[model samples]
Structure formats: structure tokens, C-alpha cells
Target: MPTPRPRPSRRRLLLQAGAAAAVQVVVRPAAAQEPPALATLVAQFAGPQKVREGRVKLEIAQMVDNGNVVPMRVTVESPMTEADHVTEIAVFNEKNPQRDVARFQLGPRSGKADVATRIRLATSQQLVALARMNDGTVWSDSVDVIVITAACLETTTSS
Candidate 1:
């Protein structure tokens, strides 16, 4: 004969319900809020909260064979001098789970405001690169890329 399973007690059921309710209360607000857009992220990145639409070069392939790891490079046209140099460079993606992709810090001694890296894309979308200068001015540029194989997309198996 098969052994019967014991039923949970009333107190145990109440405790579980209370815990679930607490979790819901904590998570509801976050779920209701939408993620910040790329422009908003750029504004937050800029020290003075001002952004110029160009002067930062964002280089990426127009079409990517795979989205798993796409090569990207950002080069800002700056002298990289003590009085005028690039302070930071931030990369943001439109369709990714997280908007911010990468951030590179540089100073006058660095001699250059360029960065190269591989980033994963969730899908075909536009990417923005913003550079903050030591003079408190922010510059930005964007590129559109088509990804054949998307990254971070969940594939479901049929039972």
C-alpha cells in the first residue's frame, strides 16, 4: 500500500500565505515601474545633465551574424589634455534587459578616449554612446545594428 501524505496544518497554511503577501507588497511597486529609457540614462550619466547629440563615435557592424558577442568600439574626438579631456564613456542599448552596457574612465594622462569591447544584444536595436568631458560637457552618438541571433532570449521546450 502507498503511504498517505500528511496535510499542512492551518497555522502552517496561514504562515505561507502571510509570507507570499509580504513578498507581493515588496515587489508590486517595482513591477509597476518601467525601466529608464536610453536618453534618460544618458542624462543621468552627464554630470551637468546636458547632452550634445554628436562628437562621440560609436562603431559597430551594421548587421551582426550573431548577437551572442558583438564587437564594438567607441572613440571620442578629444585632445585628452589636462584642461580638456574625456572623463567617462558610457554605452547604452535600447532593447537589452539592462540599458547600460559598459563604462570606461579616462583622464588627461590616458592620452586617448577610445574603448573596445564585446557586448551581447538581446535583439536588433539602436545603441548609444555618451562621453562626458572634464569641462562638464557631454557628447553622444548612436548606431543601429541588426542581430541575426539574439542573446538573452529564452527558448522554451515543448513537453
Candidate 2:
């Protein structure tokens, strides 16, 4: 006759293993998020085709006292005719919470391909303006502006 040995309970086994195992809590530094570049955002709209560097003018101050409301003007060289005109105009930024700031849709009937508005910038960076013509050609221009007071500033609380 042979004697059988009893198996330990699942709770008892976990308790015994817990005593020998070491628990560690690792804290990792939060990675800062960076916005995409102007080129990257333009490619998203016009693809990787070559964009002409002229015909589009970006009028903005070289230095801005406040980024909350920076005046901007975008004018494209076009006849504004039904045959040849500016189809779309887009504004982009290098460093901001959002890469694409504004987009305006226009046509020959709009009288002109010029747009004037205000935009918010997080910091001093390059501002790009792109225009898509009716001929399927894309034109662009950029301006570098220094912002004294940045927008989109957030307040963080420590735990």
C-alpha cells in the first residue's frame, strides 16, 4: 500500500510565493509632445509634389507683442477670372497646439484671392501660407515672426 501526499491550496501557494517576490514601482518621466513641421502638414493636403515658392505673399509683423491675436494677410497673384483663379488658401505654423491654423475657400467669383484675419501662435515660429490655383498648381510662402507672449499656455498642477 502507498500513501498519497496532499496538494497545497491555491491561496497558500500564492502567499508563499508573495513572500519571496520583490515588488517594484517604476516612475517614468512624461515625454513632451511636439507639433509637426510645416512641410509635414502641407504634404498632408497637397501631397509630395513640388510647390512653387512665389505668387503667394504672407504679410505679418516680424515681431508680435501678443500671440493671442496676430494680424495676418495672405494675397495670391491671380487674375481672379473663371479660367484662372485661386481655389484654396491655407495657413500653417511650425510650433503650435494645432498645425493648421486656418483655411479659406475662394473662387473667381469671390473677386480676389486675398484674405486678412488674426491667428493665435504658441511661440515664435515660421508661418506658412499655401494657395492652390485652378490650374492644379500649388504656391506657398512663409514668414518668421517673434511672439513676445505665447498663446495656448496651460496651467499644470503637481500631484
Candidate 3:
């Protein structure tokens, strides 16, 4: 084998390191930004409505054994009449990469004010349910979930 090439000079190595660090600093913000929290998501959708409790029921396990798919159900007390039906139900996860899990739009034809679905939880956090009534009012409820094993990708940090 040919003689090993001489190691890079200290000055050149330091310059290369500085360049690499600068590139990382430039690229980090875009790749590391997270989505808005649950409360912010609700505010964005509802636009200044007072969120009231007790009118809606959010059924989710207090502790989820798996985070890939957690069962969730939401029910609202509403007459399924043309004038007062629950028109929409939105599910949000407070700690997920994306806050809004899903939104189901209903109408008088749905004949009920309830919905059930499975959602992905990023971590142990609160899940919120928002119900929009046919009469232009919104109601909400929230429940906490304890996640023993995280399912979502861990947030990457560069030091």
C-alpha cells in the first residue's frame, strides 16, 4: 500500500468543522419545527368561542398500552333534529407531531351525535374533543393519557 496521506492541517480541520456547524445551524430550524399544540389548534378552528365542559363526553383509556392506535370515542348530548344536531367532531392530540388527529363532519342524516375512531398518540398528553352544533355553537372536552411506551418517532436533537 502507498504511504498514508498526511493528516489534514489543524487550521484546515477547524475550518471544515466550522463549515459543517454553519450548515447544520442553517438547516435545523426547518427540519426541527413542531406543529402547534392542541389548544392552539382548537383556537384556530373555533375562532374565539368559549370552550365549555360537561356537555361532551370523551371516552379514552387513562393509560394506553400502545401508542400506534389508541381507541377514542366522543359523544355529545344533542337532539338529532334539523335545528340542533352535532355537525362536526374534531379530535386533537396535545403532544403529537400533528395536533389534529381527525375531523368528522356530520349532518342531520347521521342521526346521532357520537363518533369513534383510533388515533396515534405521540406521548402521554391530553386529548381534546371539539363538537360543533348545527346552531353555530362549539363544545369541547379533554382527557389525559399515560403512555408507557411511545409510538411516534422521537424528536431529534442536534447539539
Candidate 4:
């Protein structure tokens, strides 16, 4: 008569599963924990459309003493006619708790695709300005600003 094989212990199976789970945690290394990257935010805003680097211009100070109200202007080169015009302009920040800073909607009667305003910065990071045309084409421009004093502070509480 052939001898019956012994079944693997439940303890051994649990250890194997634990080891596999640990490996996954080590490989990912806080990717899910960390905030979304700037590119991800841009992708979410642009939706599947490709963003190009042209037409839109972002003008802001390269360096600022305070981030409370940093001035900026976004301008796009387009003919404000029913045939062609800028539909929207958006500003995004890399370090802010909210990726979206502002969004302005316009139409052919808007005359020009220019917007100037002040924004608060949490820290020194890149700012991206985007323009969406009536044809669904997207244009972008980015600038890096150094902030001496941060206007926003992010705090995390562990419960």
C-alpha cells in the first residue's frame, strides 16, 4: 500500500502570504500614501488630450519675498472670433493641497485670452498655466518660483 502524503500546515501558508504582502509594501514604498504628482493632476485636468508647450505664456516673478499674494498673468495667442478662441484658462500648483488654483472660462466674445491675478503658495514649486481652445487643443506654460515665506502650512494628524 502507498503511504498518504501529509497536508501542508496552516501556519506555513500564513507565513508565505505574510511575506508576499511585505514584499509588495516594500516595493511600492508609500506611493499610495504620498500625494498625486503634478503630471497626474495635469492629466486629470486635460482629460486624454495632449498638452503642448506653446501659445500660452505665464508671467510671474521668478523670486518672491512672500507667497501670500504672488502676482501672475496668463496670456494666450488666439483670435477671439467665433471661428477660433480660447475656451478656458487654468492655473495649477505642485505643492498646494489642492492642485487646482483657479479656472477662468471665456468665449469668442471675451476679446482676449488674458488673465492676471494673485495666488497663494504653500511653498517653492512650479506653476503651470494652461489654455484650452475652442477646438479642444490644449496649450501650456510653466514657471518656477522661489518663495521666501510660505503662505500655507499643511498639517497631518494621526488618529
Candidate 5:
């Protein structure tokens, strides 16, 4: 019987191996790094606007049993007028990396300066609601949260 064709030549095998290694290097996912604090995230994303306290209202549970879907609401006392309406609202979580979770933009037609949504928190920490008005002023409010079972923590720690 004819001897099986010798395996691919050594040079071809080495070239194939090198190509595979290159592909692996290219396909690897970005490395995970520690997430910044809520205030730092806000500062980075908020630009140069002056962030003022107490103009926005943030509502979150004092104790959250589940971190996967924590309820949050934000309201700003604005008339929603053509000239004075809220332009944007952003949510930030203190314990989560990339804490700026969601942003909503509103106009005069929105009728109210309020928004509600569920967000994920990595652990027990503070949550912040920031609102930007049409006149270039930024308002914010924050509330501390206590998470009994954080989904991210559980998943990361394999507990």
C-alpha cells in the first residue's frame, strides 16, 4: 500500500500554527478592568457642565434584594416649556463599572420631566440622577442603596 502522504511539510505546519496564533491574538476580547466610581464616571461623561445638587429627584429602594433589576425613577421640577424643558436625564450607579447606565433626551413635547427604568448595580452603593436643562444647567440627586444579593457579585465570584 502506498505510504500515506507524509503529513504537511514542516514549514507548512509552522506557517499554519503561526496563522492560528495571530488569529487568536486578534479574536481575544478586550480585557476587563476595574470600573470607575460613580462620581468619576459622571465627571468624565458630563463634560465641563457645572453639576449642581438638589434640583433633581432620585428615587431608589433603601434596600434592594436583587441587583439585576433595581427600580429607579428620576424627576425634575421643570415646567416643560419650550424654553425651560429638561433636555436630558442620565443615571449612574456608584458600584458599577461604566456606571452611566442610561440616558434619555426630552423635549417640550415630552410633557413631563420624569423618567423611570430598571438598572443593574454591581453592589450596594449610591445611585445618582442627573438632569440637564435647555439653559445649560445640570442638576443632580443621589441616594444610597443596600443590595442583599447582587447579581453581578454573585456571577463574578461564582458564589
Candidate 6:
């Protein structure tokens, strides 16, 4: 019959666990734990092209009693003709679970580049709206919204 191996001591087991944890701490990178910057998210959506400011308008309240349903309006200055028109409109939020809030597609036949809708805000944070033209030029606008009552976050606090 083969001989049985001796069980490891409690102190030896604890020392091995501590060494493993230290190795993990040394191997993991710090930046990987951080959330992506809002600008990075915007750039990802806009593609590799440069993004300009203007020709886009975003309207939302600076302060609100509730974030469950906040009114939002975005207008892009475009003639809405076959030669010149807004191609797409997208909304992004800083504090939401996801960076993108909504996106809308349009064309010259639409006759207008204005959109009105309601979006949920997690808390007090910034919201960015971007519009793309037929020629591939992009325009943007941003607004800060304060939510007295949060819609996405589990807890809320007012500043």
C-alpha cells in the first residue's frame, strides 16, 4: 500500500494565500479599474474624423425635480435639401449605465432636423448631442442637467 501524505499546517496555508494575493496586486494594472472618460466615448461614436462645435443645439433643463422623464430637444441647423441635410443625431450621457442615450437617423426627405423626446437621467451630469451632416461633417453641443431624483442609480444625493 502507498503511504499517505501529511496535511498542510494552517500557518503554511495562510502564507500561501497571502503570497498569491500579493502577486495579483503586483500584476494588475491600475488604469484597467477606471471607467472610460466621456470624451473617449464621444470620439468612439464620431469615428476617426474630427468633430466640430456648432450647428447643433441641445435643450434641456439645468435643474429638474425628477429624472424619470426629462424633456430634451435637439436641433441641427440644416437646409434639409438633397444637397445639404443632417444625416444622423445621437445623444450621450456621462452618468448613465451606458454612454449612449439614443440615436436618430434622418435624410433630406425628412424636411427637418429637429427632434424632441424624453430621456432618463441618472443624476447630475453632462449630456452631449452630436449631429452628422451629409458631407460627413460633425457638429456637437452639450448641457449639464441636475436631477433632484435619480432614475438609474439606486441611491440619490443632491448637491
Most accurate candidate by TM-score: 4
Task: Tell me the whole-model lDDT of each prediction, alpha carbons only.
Answer: 0.84, 0.83, 0.79, 0.86, 0.79, 0.86
Give RMSD (Å) of candidate 5 vs. truth.
17.7
**Candidate 2 positional error at 33, Å:** 19
Tell me each candidate's TM-score.
0.72, 0.73, 0.72, 0.74, 0.70, 0.73
- Report the error of model 6 at residue 72, Å: 0.3
User: Model 4, 74-130: lDDT tens per residue?
Assistant: 999999899999999998988977778899999999999999999989887788998
- Runs in model 6 lying further than 4 Å from the true structure: 1-35, 154-159
What is the C-alpha lDDT profile of model 5 across 1-159, one tens digit per residue?
888887789999878976875565456455623245656777765679878987799988877778889888899999999988999999877667656778999998999988998888887677778888998888888776767567665345555
| Number of the candidate with higher TM-score, 2 or 6 | 2
Candidate 1, clashing residue pairs? Answer: none
Q: What is the C-alpha local distance difference test score of candidate 4?
A: 0.86
Clashes of 2: 0
lDDT of 6 by residue, 2-112 (tens): 999999999999789768756655665744322456788778878976889999999999878799999999999999999999999999988887778889999999989
Query: Which segments of candidate 4 are over 4 A away from where they belong?
Result: 1-36, 156-159
Which ranges of candidate 5 are over 4 A from the true structure?
1-36, 154-159
TM-score-wise, the better of 4 and 6 is: 4
**Residue pair clashes in candidate 5:** none
**lDDT, candidate 3, 1-159, per-residue tens:** 899899999999978976874665465464433235655788876776776666689999987768888888999898788878888898888777777788999988888888888888877777888898877788988876777567876668999
Residue-pair clashes per prediction, in order, are 0, 0, 0, 0, 0, 0
**Model 4 TM-score, 2 decimals:** 0.74
Task: Indicate the worst ten consecutive residues by lDDT in candidate 1.
Answer: 27-36
